[model samples]
Target: MRVLLLDNRDSFTRNLEHLLVAAAGADVTISAHPQAADVAAQRWDLVVISPGPGRPCDHPGYGPWIDGGTPLLGVCLGMQILNEHFGGTTEPLPGCVHGRAEPVEFLGRTLRVARYHSLHAATVGSGLEVLARTRSGIVMALRHTERPLLGFQFHPESFLTEDGGSLVHSALCLLGLR
Candidate 1:
């Protein structure tokens, strides 16, 4: 599979790239967060929005990609971006979470995922379904009801996440890439 991994100036992007390859056998291309127009000009089987600092509003220009019919996987801030693009709201968590591991029920299993975020989706967007959440009710995973779009609030590439590769494989399966 050909994947375009959009870098949001985050540190974990390289790890994500590696996981995409090892888990999904994807030919991944890393690009510093490109404009929607730039992304629209390319041919990609899948597009990955990497986790990054700041709120979704801080990093704009992803609407076209989200609505253009191409499959997309968003991580952390990227997931917030997806929510915001689809008319959801993002707000600060009561207490910011960073570099912590938490258990979430996903795909019929409890997965310990690494979370690093200060903000979260206050309301999910139209046509999107909540797939998983933390014990405290923080949204952990989501997918569009009709579109091939998925988002993860936690970092699957983080070493802290046990069976991280399986999460990547699960994402591909959800996106219909497997």
Candidate 2:
């Protein structure tokens, strides 16, 4: 499958691109906010939103690209995008929610990964489901109600996260990539 990787000022876009390429055997195209239009001009089967130091609301035009029915993978700030897409607010997780954990207590038990963010959005819209979260109630994982949209609040590309590689692979699996 072909996927478009959104560049959010984070190198993880390239990192995930490689990881996703090796893991899912898919062609990934990387693009930044300025080049978003060009990326949209192309035909992509899915979109992967990588973590950025910025907020989704900051990029008003980007909402439509993400809200579209195409499958999506939201990571870090990308996760917040999913929440915002579903009408949620993103504030700090009360503290530095970026670190390593054995397994965060969500619906089940998701391995702790690097979460580098201070701003979190609180959802006010609908069409989103919480797939995972920390004990602090910061929604970490979410999905779109209508299409294939998955959001994760952690960086699955950091070497500290051994399972991150597999986590992204699982996202592709959900999209039937494997």
Candidate 3:
């Protein structure tokens, strides 16, 4: 599958690229400073928004992708960007969570996944559906109601997380590429 991987210039982008290519045989293109117009000009089977170090609202390039029909996956700060662009709100965590496992309820199962984010989505817009949340009720995952967009606050590409491949595979499954 042809995939557009938006690199937010984070430490995890390369790892994500490697994992997607190996796990799903995706033809991935990495773009660090992605402009919305430049992104809209490309054709991709799937688009991945990688983790970054700051608030999603700080970036002006993410708003346009919300209306595009292409399947999109947002990881860490990318998830936050999706949330914020859809009229949701994000708040700083009481403490930074890195290299830790947290219980996230997904698809009727509680899975312990690696956590590496300090911001949590407090509320989502009407167009989005919450797919998972932490034990403390922090939004951990979300999907657009009528679109092929998905978001995960956790870093599924991190080797620290057990069964991280499952997350990657699930994304491909959502895109019907698995």
Q: What Cα-based lDDT does every candidate model obtain? A: 0.91, 0.72, 0.82
Compute the lDDT for candidate 2.
0.72
Return the top candidate by lDDT.
Answer: 1
Candidate 3 lDDT, 81-134, residue by residue in tens: 888888888888888788898767676666678899887887896699988887
Model 3 ranges off by over 4 Å = 36-40, 176-178
Question: Candidate 1 lDDT, tens digit per residue, 85-110?
Answer: 88999999988999999889999999
- lDDT per residue for candidate 2 within 12-116, as digits (tens), equals 677788878877787888877724567777778878887877677775555677656677888888878777766687765566655564456544545766666
Q: How far is candidate 3 from the true structure (C-alpha RMSD, Å)?
A: 1.8
Q: Candidate 1: where is the Cα deviation over 4 Å? A: 36-39
- In model 1, residue pairs whose N, Cα or C atoms come closer than 3 Å (at least 3 residues apart or on different chains), thus clashing, are none
Identify the superior model by TM-score, candidate 1 or candidate 2: 1
Could you tell which candidate, 2 or 3, scores higher by TM-score?
3
- Candidate 2 C-alpha error for residue 176, in Å: 4.5
